[model samples]
Target: MQDNLYDCPEYPLLLILSGPSGVGKDTVARMLIERRPDSFYFVVTATTRPPRDNERDGLDYFFVNFDEFAHMIETNELLEYAIVYNDYKGIPKQQIRDALASGRDVILRVDVQGAATVRHLIPNAISVFLTTRTEGGLVRRLHQRKQDTQEGMALRTATARQEMKRLAEFDYCVVNPEGRPEVAVERVLSIIDAAHCRTHQEPVRL
Candidate 1:
């Protein structure tokens, strides 16, 4: 066994979590924040979608309208942004930078496309791909949300199938089978622990 295993010294680490919609990405992220509130900072994404009931500004998302989103795109303020389900969603560079500089383990719950963009920008970032054991499970979870119509659910399922193909591109894959949110959270936490022990240069602060 290797001796003197490096202890991650409260340095900033960016953990990019991506997966198909309804694969429990948000659920896993929420658990992490709740379990280790001091150790991790959940990065809030900016979106053009109207906030749903019970969703608060700067919590669930940084809600914005179309015009503001378009202006952000024009100014290149977003590190990565994409139109998903006809709504603009993106990570703001300044928010990420600030979080990193503060030596917080910043976790981003983003789509596969946004994850890919983060990988390109921060090559050493830990990328975790969340997945469901089967397509049926994905469909079921989407339906449980009751936020989407039948047609919307169908579109999400179709999109999920396409996103699943990118699994190989991630560093690790965790299956949130049967919506076991705790299991998924543990798997991701294990990956984060393992990553901290690797012998690599410290990640760029922000």
Candidate 2:
């Protein structure tokens, strides 16, 4: 019926790209979407945290107040949500459903805790854990960010160390070295390609 194996239709994928705070999850997510804009849909997360000077409300994150976030939770509109570094963040359900319905691979950039919750909810979703090449590298990145106060930075560093121990929970561990995010993006693309070619692919349950 088909001309060749390449002609077979492939199912869309739900990919969770997660890591500790400073491992470049956002960078890698942006690169993936840039590389496959038509086939990939990046899920913008909604957060109760105040936006930074350079961040936009709908583009970088759906910046919401505590009341709005609570409303979303009450209405069961979020797919998975968690408090991170004293701020609430969540993935919206309808945007993901719409993207998957349109056959675009959905990508979610979340922290390690949120990733675990999403994996439990969507067992068939592919989860990738991103980390720097060395623990010291991660620490340096966290320190260099300077977005947080000294106490806040200390807390984030401690939390990141704890999150690193969660590497086993993910399907793949990617080393996103500093300033070389493109390499990590290439590896992620390869993973997506391999997933599409699996002989016994499990339909993502969402």
Candidate 3:
């Protein structure tokens, strides 16, 4: 009985959910946390970008000023940091360490660039690339936001196209169809389940 029980043991997973701008990465991550509240820990990213009206400081993002962001970088508090569209965005190292120590799977929602950095730091981490069904759909969604100027939109669209070509770097890619984030959430969960059942699961060390 003891030998049989040793055949399988669970190890916390570090799952990176990333994609190009305007692809529903945030939506999918939100639903994934809601679906498995107890088993998953959503990593709140730190950024210099100001929060929108509905976004909470720590909950939505760890909003900070440029100086403070620079201080974090100087002190090496970030697991991965990048200059994203003129703003500084990064993941806090402590949060991930604490969450993983608690035996909960950590979900990091980041841009494609940040994802690559994290993958390099934690090679065993599983990465999932979220994408729209088509490039046209992605552009349409960005335009629908109505928040960016024409030049800003054009830059984002061009960058997104380049990011799409990096899909082969990720372990899995999921299509997030318009208005259907739950479908993508289920797919992500399925991937986590499979990772746990791998024959030679390696413990994710920070």
- lDDT for each residue of candidate 3 in 1-206, tens digit (9 for 90 to 100): 34555568679999999999999887888888899899999999999998877789998899999999999999999998999999999999999999999999999999999999999999999999999999999999999877789999999999999999999999999999898888888999999999999877778876
Error of 2 at 121 (Å): 0.7
Give every collision pair in model 3.
Answer: none
lDDT of 1 at 40: 88
Local accuracy of candidate 2 as per-residue lDDT tens digits, 73-167: 99999998988888999999999999989999999999999999999999889999999989899999998888999999999999999999999
For each candidate, what is the lDDT?
A: 0.87, 0.92, 0.93
- TM-score of candidate 1 versus the correct structure, residues matched by position: 0.91
Index of the highest-TM-score prediction:
3
Cα-based TM-score, every candidate? 0.91, 0.95, 0.96
lDDT of 1 at 14: 92
Off by over 4 Å in 2: 1-9
> Model 3 misses residue 182 by how many Å?
0.9
Error of 1 at 125 (Å): 0.8
List candidate 3 stretches off by more than 4 Å.
1-5
